[model samples]
Target: MRSALLHVSVPFVLCVTLANTSLFDEVKVDLAYDHYAERRVDYLPSFLAMPCNCLVNLAYIYMGLYWLLNCRGVKETEQGRYMREVFAFMAVLYAPVQWVRLASLRRAPAVLDQWFTLPIFAWVPVWISSIQRRPARWRAPGAAVVQLLSLLSYGLSLAHERGFEVALGCHVAAAVYKGACVQRDLGDGRTRVYLLLAVLSCAGFVVLKLLDHWLSRYWLFQRLTGHFWSKVCDVLQFHFSFCFLTTLTQRAQGKTASQEE
Candidate 1:
């Protein structure tokens, strides 16, 4: 996996560098300041944004590779193999979604950005839950229902207030419910540490988002790294979710093995 990822990174990094070079050149021209004191278009330090973008994309690519490796170990059942493939495919989706979001922001409404991301957040738990086989009786349908309601609530809330509260509220509830079910099935072990970290990561993701939103309202934040910080938190949150879900899935498998013995 490491070797494969390293080979993949070479092309990925080269592409990003070339893309950003063109993008920044265009942004400079389009966002140029007027001599007569007209307002400046919103922009960030290219140095900062470039590196952050690279890191975010790298994290996503790594997760995709991780799942590709995981797929090899999941041959016990057809369902397991399919789930692992789905995980890998979702990981691959992250980078393209980000690219589309960047393209949208260049000429489209900011709301279009959410179109690329919101569904991913909603469906992620459902996918992970299905793989973990928690809530054994209704795992698939239950997970689907939770994600659907979360998305629907988010859509309505976004229409009414144009903020993340209602939808994020539903997401948190779903995460908690899913986490609780996982916890109930686990016997005491170090996997508990992974669960704890997952919870902490979720909390951190929320706090960082709230802070970024609040601080971005002030000009000082633009100069001092509010946006960059938000990017970092976004990368961390996605990586942490992968860690938690994979660890929990392994623990579930362990329990199944012990029971069969």
Candidate 2:
């Protein structure tokens, strides 16, 4: 009951706050001009125009709640240590990156409108470090292939300006590969439900990309909002994948221990 209330409260507050804001307009504007801008855009207009900040704060709140709810898993010494190291690295990196981005805003090129960075740098490094330090005993060959495909998709995104035909292909391939690995690790049960959700989320992104592509020509904005959305989708997908894999591994380990006992 407490957990259910906690889950409901944060999003409810966020929704209420966002209901009064111009966030939707901002997102529309941001998406409209994301590709054509050249300079460091002010955060105020975007912040005032959109509810992204509110949403992000809400995400942090939920993360805190999740940590509280799953304190046992998070408190494990190995995971705790890795998280600390990752946070430290992010602290070191975010300042310099932000400073550079702010400084670069004074000189805007035609191709470079507003340069923005996702704050996920805070958690991503930690996730990678955790994966490295606590290696999975059962290495899924498909996971390696998925990672490679993801990398290739990223590269294709950098190369292709219009539609993500190549990137989409790579993304789908990687999603399928990763889904296979997740299914293999989790077996057929509750874990499979989580993995399936992740797979669907990944596939859903392709639909978003297609919509963005279809709408690209209608807008006259000078920014690359679609590009930013694509990048955001990529980051979110990666986070979901990591969480899915980690949880599956932990479940597998628990099953092994129970069998031995």
Candidate 3:
């Protein structure tokens, strides 16, 4: 299973690496004060000019792909159902976020830039509506955890210029927590292994973030570029792990059913 995961991860890693390179070049251009200043003169172009905006857009694409491939029609147990609900909730929340992006900024904020911070209110009611229909088991602790992290990340972003970092960290942490919750609910060895790998990948990201913070320097762009490459590796690892575990679980289930027959 581990070997299979490594195989699946290769392409994702390559894509992330390429994306990082592109992001670095784009951000470097964005950092040029004169270019940025001139671009801001035209609101539409300036908003579109930010590389962080592009990164966020790309991240959304990845999120959608992950949901379609991993979350849709893949629930094998009640825990799996809960997991799906969580992601569905996320999808709901992200809808307004994307909409606001289009209507308000049309571009992404920098790591240090502040924009509209209260967009959560727009979609909070949607999540609440969904939560009300779900089973009570899926309501309290599970929904609480997800909502707490979501709101906390937004608040952190508002309080600090480096709010993007807080948001990313919260996201990684939520993924790990969700994986663990699913693993506990499923009781499948293969699924548990995949969850562990997901946790590890998120841990790798946390470490990279800490390193970046501790080693701050004026020429931090170089360091950020390096971290971006590392992020690519982690994403690849996550993709491969998920693919292999999913395959293994399906195969094992097939064997069990055949044996019963």
Candidate 4:
């Protein structure tokens, strides 16, 4: 899995090195230490400049590892397994990309950080598509197409100041809308809980990050900071997404088996 992810990400990372970025105008990227509410420790290395924010990125890896390793609890189709693995791989990959941005505070890593986000969010709908039917051969191609479109949407950042925001908003909206619909149609009480938690986490991930600086005026948000909490929320959302998708996939598989028998 790691090898496959490397094969996919290495070229993408290289491409990001060649890509132009929107540090100031388009996306809200924190370039300097002052951009974050967490105070940088002068004694620490550059990687741990903002200790809380830096250390929090490890949560993504841990969450991804938890999902990636625990594949035994539920049985799923080949396509469903593929979807889960790819999403887990994305979480694992995302950790370092964000860390590198905080460490280097460079253009490429920052750009790569934001660019990678779109496709990750886009996967929600692709996973929903998988739930809508039996596992088919074409699911992979369909997923690839969704991801490709998501990747190309980053081009909007170069074209407009708020383009990335617009793209991200659409992705989030689509994920929420589709998730809500699926939960309404086919979900039980447990899946409903997962979906609600995922949505709340998604909201926290966005709202907290947006309020990073503003929230710092309060005492509670001073140390760990809004950004750090936002990361925590992001990890929670990832975990819940895994929960929701896997549970739904397992149920779908059971229904299929029953019909077959």
- Per-residue CA lDDT of candidate 1, range 36-133, in tens? 12122347442223344334555666776676675574433443444444445446655654544333334221232343245456655665566566
Question: In candidate 1, where is summed lDDT lowest over 10 consecutive residues?
Answer: 27-36
lDDT of each: 0.50, 0.39, 0.40, 0.84
Q: Model 2, which residues run further than 4 Å from truth?
A: 1-44, 50-172, 212-243, 258-261
User: lDDT: which is higher, 2 or 3?
Assistant: 3
What are the per-residue Cα lDDT tens digits for candidate 4 across 47-110? 9988889999999999988888789566666677777888898899899989999999976778
Candidate 3 local lDDT, 1-261, one digit each (tens): 233234223422443354344332322112332322111234455334433322343443475357445565663434333333343333333433433443344234321121122222212222322332333223545444544445445445445556555565545544455445444544477656665665566566456534543343435533343244334444544454444334444444455456669
Better of 3 and 4 by TM-score: 4
Model 1 spans > 4 angstroms off: 1-55, 74-76, 103-109, 116-118, 124-150, 187-189, 213-224, 257-261
Q: How far does residue 160 in candidate 2 sit from its true spot (Å)?
A: 5.6
List where candidate 4 sits over 4 angstroms from the true fold: 1-11, 14-17, 20-29
TM-score per model over all chains: 0.61, 0.43, 0.40, 0.92
Each prediction's total of clashing residue pairs, residues at least 3 apart in sequence or on different chains, is 0, 16, 1, 0
Better of 2 and 4 by TM-score: 4
Structural RMSD, model 4: 2.5
